[model samples]
Target: MILELVRFLVFIFFVITSFMIILLVLFQDEQGDGIGGVFGGGSSSIFGARSSSVAIKITAFFITLFLFL
Candidate 1:
């Protein structure tokens, strides 16, 4: 019973993480402007220049987690 519960939880986590990864990738800017450019490639950025690196790290983490799960 516990094993089944654990498996279900992991599956749920994997699905949620997958969606998060997709959204993160879609929201990020290809021109290195970070996610702030999704709305408008302007001089203003909500996450600043450092957001790109942060997003990359998060994406990597979720990908690794997905593989493991």
Candidate 2:
């Protein structure tokens, strides 16, 4: 019973993390006219210069969590 509960929780966590990663990737700016274009321009990053790095780290973390789960 506990094992099934754990499995269900893990599945939910994975789906939530997957969605978050997708949204995070979509929010990041590329060269030009990317997701940022939807809001405005890429003249400045909302998270500053290290935004891409931060996003990459977060994505990696989500992937790692899936592997462990």
Candidate 3:
């Protein structure tokens, strides 16, 4: 039925989105440094160390949505 097809598509979309979000979240570096100071955290980061909180939040949201799907 149309409802079943819609449900299936929604499930697939959620699964794919969750996987992408997870990959991105994991790919982000947690260390407080850019490409240069990776080995040397002792040096102050020129751009400053940004927090991964946003990525974590997004990943969490995707996970919750995936579970609902």
Best by lDDT: 1
Pairwise lDDT winner, candidates 1 and 2 = 1
The deviation in Å at residue 24 for candidate 3 is: 2.5
Candidate 1 structure lDDT: 0.69
Q: For candidate 1, lDDT tens digit of each residue in 1-69?
A: 999999999889989999988987787557655554544454433345634457755766777788888
> Cα lDDT for residue 45, model 1?
37
Instruction: Estimate the TM-score for candidate 1.
Output: 0.63
Which segments of model 2 are wrong by more than 4 Å? Answer: 32-52, 67-69
Q: Write the per-residue lDDT of candidate 2 for residues 1-69, one digit (tens) a residue.
A: 999999998899989988887887787546554657333355334345534356655755666676776
Give residue 32's error in model 2 in angstroms.
7.5
Poorest 10 consecutive residues of model 1 by lDDT?
Answer: 38-47
Rank order (by lDDT, best first): 1, 2, 3
lDDT of each: 0.69, 0.64, 0.62
**lDDT, candidate 1, residue 14?**
89
TM-score, candidate number 3? 0.49
**Candidate 3 residue 37 C-alpha distance from true site, Å:** 24
